[model samples]
Target: MAVSLGFASGAIVQEFYVDDDVDRSIRDSVEAETGQALVDVDYGDVVDGAIVWWRAEDAEEEDLADVLVDAMSNLDDGGLIWVLIPKAGRPNSVRVGDVEEAAGIAGLHATTSTALGQNWAGVRLTARPRSRR
Candidate 1:
């Protein structure tokens, strides 16, 4: 799990809105593998990496876009941002297309995606480079 999530020793990672089960699994995996604890933070807190777990049906598309914008605001340069959603065909699962569209609206691109676990899948994103004046 840590390897897939790209968690590293001493890397600052934060989680937002992830379920307890998933969060515990990730935290324990990271600690066990890297011997480091992730720095968990709420929305609006800046950090080097972040994980956002949300059920697509829970919020409107616009709301999800806002959440992504806020999450991006808190990410550092060259940082990783992970968006985890319920797998397709699962109850209340979010569509991959919706997630990708929201990411584009937030000025990000989906670099990779993988199955997170039995119940969820993850999409990896990185901030778009800023345009110079």
Candidate 2:
């Protein structure tokens, strides 16, 4: 199961990785694949390991999950993936709760919290994602 961050209809978000180099690779790959530039990138960490966050365009639910899972699965031991679903409206507050539910659906564990003085929402999801090996 992967932790999910709910969106408010076409809401852009970010993808985080536990490795800097891996982060760069993911950012570059996502931009190249989507032909869209990242909104931003930042340093951070999660239960799995160190991490960096990169802004991403709004994508479909399954497509977004597949993209994130693919990028995160390449790191050492395959680091975890986190998607930041910022608040948009009255329903934006549901992102964290929705992500928790999403993680359960995917058979992954997740934790959610708010930042920026409770102005933004984020979710961290972890799991032993299936490997091609």
Candidate 3:
């Protein structure tokens, strides 16, 4: 998982922002692989990366654009975000199209997506480069 995300150990410690409702196992694995604990969304510190656990109902409850924007705000420059949603056929699963749309609105692009296991789909997000004048 760390390899796929290009995580590397460096002099500065790497930190990840963990959003709400993420699967415990996935979060644990990430923490173990990254060699550090994850900070919750309220951390208010710029992190190297972020993980957003979302559901279909969450989209209805609040704007996905808002959530993505909030997550992005907590990221460092060149940071990344992994938006994990329930896989197709799973309870509370959201459509990939919707996620992509929200990502676009948040000034991000989906770099890739992969199945996290039997139950979850993970999308990697990166910031869009500023447009040249």
Candidate 4:
């Protein structure tokens, strides 16, 4: 079996796994739920992932963030996960910085940049070790 990792957002801690397809089903589900398009980046074998962005909703960002964190935690074989919440001035305008911050809030280590390429990029957060405490 693959190594399991512990993930957290605020008070929640859950197990996670890294899959072969890098959690494509999560992307598809998010797309179907939000009716948004997703983009994939070439991390060149060193990494494999995708990004899903959509128009902002009346829902609070914190609520959405919680949903995203829980989704990542529950996703089958999911390790590297990124959730972006950019300004809602336009559709699919999730800035890399926004995603980075959300990843951070999810207690994930990440790096991002719009200059990297495309409107979106793959997830940067990977499975992290559980706290000793």
lDDT of each: 0.73, 0.42, 0.72, 0.39
Poorly placed runs, candidate 4 (over 4 Å): 1-54, 58-64, 75-78, 84-92, 112-123, 131-133
Task: Show where candidate 1 strays beyond 4 Å.
Answer: 1-3, 21-23, 31-36, 40-45, 60-62, 131-133
TM-score of 4: 0.39
Name the better of 2 and 3 by TM-score. Answer: 3
- Ranked by TM-score, the better of candidates 1 and 2 is 1
lDDT of 2 by residue, 1-133 (tens): 1212332222222444323323244344444543444333341222222122322333332444444454344433434545545454532234456566655665556754544222334566666655675
lDDT of 4: 0.39
List model 4 lDDT by residue over 28-104, tens digit each. Answer: 44445434343333222222223334223413343434544654544333334544333334444455555556566
Top-down lDDT ranking: 1, 3, 2, 4
Worst 10 residues of 3 by lDDT: 9-18
- What TM-score would candidate 3 get against the native? 0.82
Q: Write the per-residue lDDT of candidate 1 for residues 30-124, one digit (tens) a residue.
A: 56654656655553555677777878655754377777887777677778888888889986788877878888988888889888767788888
Query: Which candidate number would show the highest TM-score if scored against the true structure?
Result: 3
Clashing pairs in model 3, backbone N/Cα/C closer than 3 A: none
Instruction: Rank by TM-score, highest first.
Output: 3, 1, 2, 4
Query: Relative to the unseen true structure, what is the C-alpha lDDT of residue 66 in candidate 2, on a scale of 0 to 100?
Result: 48
For residues 39-110, could you state the per-residue lDDT of candidate 3 as single tens digits?
766676667777778888777778887888888776666777888889999988988888899999999999
Q: Tell me how candidate 3 scores on lDDT.
A: 0.72
Worst window of 10 by summed lDDT in candidate 1? 36-45
